[model samples]
Target: MLNLLVIDGVLLFLVTITALAVIEMRNLFAVTMLTGVYSLLMAAVWTNMHAVDVAFTEAAVGAGISTILILGTLVHVGVKERRREKSLNLSALLIVTLTGGALIYGTLDMPAFGDPEAPVQTHRFQKLFDQNVGKVPVTDTHHVEAVAHGAEQHGGEQHGAHEDEFHGHVYNTVTSLLADYRSFDTMFETAVILSAGLSMIMLLRRRSDEEIEAATQRTERVDPDTIKTERMDPKTTQTVRVDSPPGSDSSGADKKLAAEIAEAVDSAEQIQHDAPEETDKGDQV
Candidate 1:
């Protein structure tokens, strides 16, 4: 009991100090690493308290991957926090008060810490370890019952029509579920570990020549003209004449249009000249 208290006190002390450091430290990289150490210490505490799975996740994700990725980002961009310390006003105090009140109201319904008679521990945790793997709750025990109803479900019966018994141990029913009943889940967990490894490799990875080529192929080719150039009227001619003198335009097409207009005017004038003058001479006769 004294040792347990000592352990708890030490953990609490570390947690408090780490929290303060996290809040006070201006260096984001240092804060991230500190957060990882905090998580590692928390995992240690959880393991000491006999919650193994939670500890494992904290070790892998919180301490290892999260820390690495965050620190990597800090290295790339910067190590400084974006904002300075906030000055607390009345609004801040009021909001804090409301939040504290709500938290207190929520806490009123919570069971006291370490109450052994709490429904969670006495029923859920103890029952899981005590129950038989054959008697898995809410499952079709048909196949399991048919083969090894009494004996442990391992070392017997081929699954999926293959020549081997279900590849699993029946020590814990959940493990039995993961390994045998849900072998895909075991594969999924292995896949998660594989993904983490792949992520680590990718985060630190260099692209191969083929990969680079493939990426280049995947990228869309952009037209320089189509990009953000100064918007100008495309119909307007780009070539500026060296001299502004008459008939000195560089484009013969412009001079040609003027000649066409002049020829049309001449044709109209000749048509008017050839027309006979109309008179009332027939009526006089």
Candidate 2:
């Protein structure tokens, strides 16, 4: 009993320290990891108290699912938390104190740890154990042997009869209680776990606004003729040229040809006018 108490106290102390560290942590990534550690410590505490079902649930959801969800969120939102300088609020402290006091007061009514005569043991479980005990064989032969040995060490007779009596019986009372007596509760817990998993999937399996916009932009239809090809010079800014389709004339070359044709036409007209004047002058002479 002293050893159990000592281990429980040490585990409780570690749990408290981890919780405080999580609270004081400013980096969200560290906080998330610490939260997982806290849940695992809590699961250990529950296992030590013989609440294996609760421990399993805590380890799976709190340490596994919840940690993954938080890490996913961290990947999206980044690891740093924004901090603002401000004076402490007395009201908040007062509220926290009152809540803590209420919780402590509530624990006062609970039975002492491992109290064999607790109401739950004497009233709630006695009948359940009577109904289902010894239905399944204790799987571990070592445990059976140990029990028989302990009985013999205590100078108790009929060790063989005790072994025979407990033959084919499950050694774990918790399993029987959960599987037989509180099956409905376990079933509901499973349902809750499924629901929570679905909720996390819905929350995490999402496309962000930026991602949606980028996809939309990628799939947007652009006219082939409207596409602009751009080239940049180190000294110049934002120069663009239109792309010509295959077999199409280059715009710059086309403009140059037009200018040459107009200039040739104008020069030929000038020569024709000058020739007429020259011919008139020769006839007059």
Candidate 3:
């Protein structure tokens, strides 16, 4: 008992210190790493308390895959904290304090660790072992007749079916509980993990409208004909040229548009009145 207390005290101290350090950390990446360490410490505490299943879950989920997932998220979201203001929000602090107090109050009713007289050991385990071993007739005689009658109604074939469920029984009771008794819970946990992975995939994909539009525009080829070279009157196809003489305060845009129009007109004239000799020379070339 003394050794157990010492181990628990040390693990609790480590967990508390790691948690406080995580809270005090300004770097998000460092915080993430400290949070994993905190989880590992909690797993150590659970292992010391002989809760190997819970310890395995904490180590694999809380410390292992969860840390990797958070780091992957940080790759895109970045590790820097966006500090908009240094002032602490009183309302947030009040909410956190109230929530923490409520949680602490709730833990008051929990049984002490490894208490042999706990309800689980007395009620659930006793009933399970008694039912399996067929010892002590499994009753205090108050409802013996009722229990016998119920057993008669639900025994034999039902009991045989239950035994058949574990036809190749294993040594591990936890395995049997998870695979046989609470199989649906195990299945649902698997489904939840799959759904979370799908959710992460969906979130990490750059699927926003703006991002899609930018990618499309970046890859699109713009045609020269699609570009507006001259300012045209909406009512007519004629180009609107500036009448100001060469060196007035006319804008470069207006000059470029005028030059474009003049070049277009000259090209059309040349195409319409080109000499047959020039055409034949072109054809020969």
Error of 3 at 8 (Å): 0.7
| lDDT per residue (tens digit) for residues 179-212 in model 3 | 7567899999899989988997797764557545
Which tens-of-lDDT digit does each residue in 148-218 have in candidate 1?
A: 44433544322222332333335556565556656887898899989988997887765556545544653
How does each model score on TM-score?
0.50, 0.55, 0.58
Native RMSD of candidate 2 (Å): 25.7
Residue pairs whose backbone atoms clash in candidate 1: none
How many residue pairs clash per model? Answer: 0, 6, 0
Off-target runs (Cα >4 Å) in candidate 2 are 85-89, 132-171, 201-218, 221-285
Candidate 2, residue 131: how far the Cα is off, in Å: 3.3
RMSD of each: 21.9, 25.7, 20.1
Give per-residue CA lDDT, model 2, range 13-65, as digits (tens): 99999998997788999999999999999999999888888899899989998
The weakest ten consecutive residues by lDDT in model 1 span: 222-231
Cα displacement (angstroms), candidate 3, residue 44, comes to 0.7
For model 2, the run of ten residues with the poorest summed lDDT: 230-239
Question: How far off is residue 66 in model 3, in Å?
Answer: 1.5
